[model samples]
Target: MKDLFDYCDFGDLKLNSRIVRTGLWESQREKSGNMTPDIYNRYENIAASGVGLIITELYSLYPRDTFSKYSNTIHYTQFVREARDLTDLVHVYDVPIFAQLGFVQYNKKTQQNMKIEDVTIDDIRKIQTDMIIAAQKFDFGGFDGIQLGLGNYYFLSRFINPNFNTRDDKYGGNTFNRLRIVLEMIKVIKDNTKLHINCRLNAFDGTTNGMTLTETIEIAKLLEKYGADFLQITLPRSPQFFTRENKEENPLIEATEQIIDNVNIPVILGGGANSQNQINEMLNSTNIDFISMQRPFVKDPSFLVDWQIKGNGESFCKTCNNCYWKKTATCHLRSCNP
Candidate 1:
C-alpha cells in the first residue's frame, strides 16, 4: 500500500512525502516584483510543514503578459537574489523547490497578444531564448527544477494546440511539428542547465479540435523523450474547473493513470484532492506517486504538519477559490472555517 507520507525517490530527488505543493497567484509581492516578508514567511511555513516538494507560484516569463500583474516575473532585477534566499530556506527543511515559469499572452512592444499562427520564427526563437535565460536564473538561484507551464491557457499550450496553432510551417501541423518549438527549447535547457525540467500539461482540453488525452499522451512521450524529468497532468482551467463540491467522477484519475502507464518519468495527478484518506486511496489504487495541491496550502501553509500528526486529516480549505480569483496568496475564508 502506498502511503501519502512515505519517503520516496521522485527522479533523483528524495522527498519527505508524496505531497507536492504547487503555487499560483503571488498577489502579495511588491509592485516592483521583489519578494516581501510575507512571501518569505509563507514559504518558510510551507517548508517547515511536510510537503515533499514545492513549486513556486507562476514566474511570468515576461512583464507585460496577462498574468504578470498577479505573478512574479523573471524580468525583476532582484529575481535571482531573492529566489536564492527562498530556495535556501526551503532547503533547510531538506525540501527541493521548483520554479514555475510561464505566461498566458505573448506581447511584444506594441503587438499586444499575438496569435499562435501569427508568431514568426524570430518570435519563436526569442521566446525560447528568454526561457533558457530564465532557467539559468533558476539554476543560479539554487532551485532543484523548473516547472514549464505548458498547461492551461499559456502561450505554449496554444502554440502546440491544433485548434489555436494552424500554422503549416515546421513549427506546426503534426504532433511532432507542433511540439517542436517546445522540444527544441527543452533540449537546449537540458544541455545548458542541471535543473530538472518538469512539464505541466493538460490531460484533455474540451475544445472540439484542441488537445485530447491521446494527443496529451503523445505529448507526454515526446516531452519525456526530449528531456522532461517528470510530468504533472492537469486540465485546461484546472483547479477552478475542479472543486471539491463537484463530486462528479474525476476523469483526471483515470487519465493520469493512463499517462503514467505511457511514460517512464514520474507523473503527478494535480488538484481536486483534499483529504489524507482520499489521497492515500488514489496513491494505492493507481500508478500515481506524486500529488499536487495549491489552494489547501494557501488556506494554511502548515496544514500538512497537522495531517502528518493526525495520520488522517481533511484540509480546512473551503474551496471557495477566493484566493484564485481575488489573486491573493492568503485564503479568504479560513477565519470562518473554524
Candidate 2:
C-alpha cells in the first residue's frame, strides 16, 4: 500500500516524501527584489519541517508584470544572487526547491497597464525571451526545478483562457493556438537549461465560457508532450467553486485524476487539503502522485512535523485567507501567532 511518507519520483527530481509545500506569496523581498533575512528563515523552517519539495512563492519575470500589491519583481540580474542565497539555504536540508514563475500585465497601481489581448506577436516573443532569461537565472541559482505558473488568472492563464484571449492570430484561436506560447516557452527552457519544468495549470475557472475542465485535461496532455515534467492542478479563486461543503472529495481531485490518465508525468493536487486523512484518501483514491498545501504552512511552519508525530490531525489553519490582505504574509490567528 502506498503512503504519504513514501518516496516519490517526480521526473528526474526525487522527493523525500509525498508532501509538497506549494508556493505561497510572501511579500518578504527587499525593494530591489532582493531576498530578506525573514524570507531566508521562513524557507529554512519549512525545509526543516519535513516537507518533500518546496515551491517558492510566485515571482514576476518582467518589471511591468506585478502579480501582487506588495511583492517585488525579479527584473534585474542582481536579484538572482539573492535568489541563489535562498536556494542554497534550502538545499542545506537536502530538500529540492522550485521557483514559481508568473506574470500579470495589469495591476491597479501600475501607470501603464496592458491586457493579454493587447500583446502583439513581437510582444509574445519578448515575453517568451523574458521567461527563458528568468529560467536561466533559476538554474544558475541552484533551484531543482522551475514551475511555470499557468494558473491563478496570471499572464499565462489569461492567454490560455478563451474568454480572455480574443486574438485571431496563430497565438489565439483553438486550443492548440492558445497553448502555443506555453509550448514555445517549454521548448526554450528545455533547450537552454538542465532545470526540470513543472507547470501549475488551471483545471477550471468556475465561470461561464471560461477554460473548462475538459479543455484543461487536454492542455495537460499537451504540456506533457511539450516537455513539462510535472503538473500541479489548481483552480481559480471563485466563491462558488470547490466549496467546503464537499471537503471529503472536491472536484479538483476528480479533475486531477482525469489529467493523470492522459499524461505519464507526475501530478500534484492542491486545494482544500488540510489534514493527513484528506491527503491519504486523495492519494489512495486518485492517480495523483503528490499533494500540496500553502495556507497550512503559513499557519504553522512545522505542520509536517505535527503530521509526522500524530498519525492524522486537522491543521490549525482556519483558511481565513487573511494572509493575502496583510502587508506581509502573516497569520493573524492568535494560535498561529502566539
Candidate 3:
C-alpha cells in the first residue's frame, strides 16, 4: 500500500518520504544577495526534518526580474562556493536538494520588460544561453537537480500561453512551437549538465483563450518526451487560487490526476495540502505518489518531524498568504518550533 512516509523512488533519486518541499521567496538573505546564517540554519532544519525532496527558494535568473529582490541570485561571486557548502550540508542529512531557477520578466539593457511577441530570435537565444549557464553553475554547486519555473505566471508561462504569445514566428504558433523555446533550452541543459530537469507547470490558467487543461496535458507529454525528469502541477496563481473552502474535492487535485495520466515521469501535486492524514488520504486515493508543500514549511521548517512522531498531525499555518504577499521566508505570525 502507498504511504506518505514510505521511502520512495522519485525518478532516479530516492526520497525519504512523499512530501516534497517547494519553496518560493527568500527574504532572509543579505542585501547583496549573499546567504546569511539564518538562511543556512533554516535549510539545515528543513533538511534534517525528513522531507523527501527539498526544492530551494527561487534563484532568480535575472537580478532585475520581478521577484529577484525576494529571491536568491547566482550573480553573486560566492554563489558557487556557498551553494556547494549548502548542498554539502543537506547531503549530510541524506536529503537531495534541487535549486529552483526562474525569472518573471525578460528585460534587456535597452528594452524594459519585453513582451513575449516582441522578443526577437536573438533575444530567445540569449534567454536560452543564460539558462544553460545557470544550469552549469548549479552543476558546479553539486545540486542534484534544477526546477525550472514554468508555472505561476512566470515569464516562460506567459511566453507559452496563447493569449500572451501572439507572435507569428516559428517560436510562437502551434503547441510545439509555443513550447519550442523551453524545449530547446531543456535540450541544451540536458546535453551539458547532469542536473535533473523538473518543470513546474500549470494545469489550467483560468484565463479566457489562455492555457486550458487539455493544452497543459499536451505540454506535459512533450516535456517528458523531450527531457524533463519530473513535473510539478500548479495553477497560474496557486496560492490565491487554493482556498480552504473545499478540501475534499479540489479541482487542482483532479486536474493533477489528469496530468499524471498523460505523463510517464513523476508529477507532483503542488500546494494546498497542510495535514498528514489528508496527504496520506490523497496518496491512497489517487495515483499521485508525490505532493509538494510551500507555506507550511515556511511556517515551520521542522514541522514534518512532529508529523512523523505524532502519526496524525496538522500544520499551524493559517493560510493567510502573508508569506506570499510579504515575500519573506519565515512566517509572519508567531514563533514556530517543531
Candidate 4:
C-alpha cells in the first residue's frame, strides 16, 4: 500500500509526501499587488502544517488582465520582491512552492473582458512575452516551479474551450489550434528559465461542447511532449452537476486515470477530495502520482497534519463553499463547528 506520507519525485521537485496543497484564491494582497502580512502568515502556517508542496494563488501576468482586480500581478518589481520573501519563508519549512500563473485580457481603458476572437497574432505574442517575463522573475525569486493555470475558467482555458472560442483563425477550430498559445507559452518558459513547469488543465467543464475528457487526455500527452514537468487535472466550477451526491467514483478521478494511462509524466488529481480514506482509496485504485486539495486546506491549514496524527481519518472541511464568496479563502463556519 502506498502511504500518503511516502515521498515522491515530481521531475526536479522532490516532495516529502504525496499530499499537495493546491492553489486557492486568497484576497489578501495589497493594492499594489504585493504580499501583505496576512498573506505571508497564511503561507507560513500552510508551510508549517506539513503539506508536501504549496501552489500559490493565481498571479496575473499582464497589467490589464482581469485577474489584476483580485490576485497579485507579477509585472511589478515590488511584487517580485514580495514573492521572493514568500519563497524564502516557505523554504524555511522545506516546502517547495510554485506560483500559479494565469492570464485574462481586459481593455486598457474600459477594463472589460476582451473577445477571444478579436485577439490577433500580435496580441498573442505579446501575452506570451509577458508570461515569459513574469516566469523569469519567478525563477529569479527562487520559486521551485511555475504551474501554468490553464484551468478554472481562466482566460487561457477560455481560449481552449470550444464553447468560448468561435474564431476562424489559427488559434481556433481544432484542439491543436486552440492549444497553440499554451504550448508556445510552455516552450517559452522552458527556454527562459530553469524553473519546473507544471500545467493545471481542465478535463471537463460539465457543459455542452466544452473541453471533454478525450480532448484533455490528448492535450495532456501533448503537454508532456512539449516539456511540461507534470500535469494537474482540474475541473471547472459547475456546482449543479459535480456537487450533487454520487456513489460512483468522481469524474475527475476517472478522467485522471485516462490521462495517466496515456502520459509518461506524473498526474495530480483532486476535486471535492475531503477525506483521507477517499484520497488513499483513489491513490491505491488508480495510478495517479499525487492527490491535491484546495478547499480542505482553506477550512483547515493543518488538515494534513491532523490526518497524519489521526491515521487516515476524514478532513474537517464541510465544503460549504463560503470561502468562494468571501474571497478570503477562509472557513467562515469554523466558529460554529468548534
**Candidate 1 local lDDT, 297-330, one digit each (tens):** 9999999998988878999988888898998788
lDDT of 4 at 265: 86
What tens digits encode model 4's per-residue C-alpha lDDT throughout 1-338?
Answer: 97777777877777878888876675867776667888888889889877888998777766666556766677566766777899999999989999888876635455367788877787788878878888899998889899997887888889888989998988999988898998998888888898888898888887788888888888888889988998888877632223426455577878888888999988888666777787778778878869887877777777677777878677776666676656665678867452
Alpha-carbon local distance difference test for all models: 0.91, 0.80, 0.91, 0.79
Candidate 1 has an lDDT of: 0.91
Compose the digit string of candidate 3's lDDT tens values, residues 1-338. 88788999999999999999999999988998789999899999999998999999999999889888999989989989999999999999889999999998998888889999889999999999999999999999999999999999899999989989998999988889999999999999999999999999988888889999999999999999999999999888888866565455567889999999988899999988888888999999998999999999989999999999988899988888889999999888885444
RMSD of each: 1.0, 2.6, 1.3, 2.2
Q: What is candidate 2's lDDT per residue for 1-338, written digit by digit as tens? A: 66787876767777778888876576777776777788888899999878889998777665555555465456656777777888889888878999888876743344455666777687788878888988988898888899998987777898899988888889988999999999999998999998889999988887767899889988988999999899888877622343345455477888888888888999888767888887888778777878888877877877787788888867887766676556355577876552
Where model 2 places Cα greater than 4 Å from the true spot, the runs are 66-69, 106-111, 238-248, 336-338
Question: Model 1: what TM-score?
Answer: 0.98
Candidates 1 and 2, the one with greater lDDT: 1
Candidate 4 wrong stretches, greater than 4 Å: 108-111, 238-248
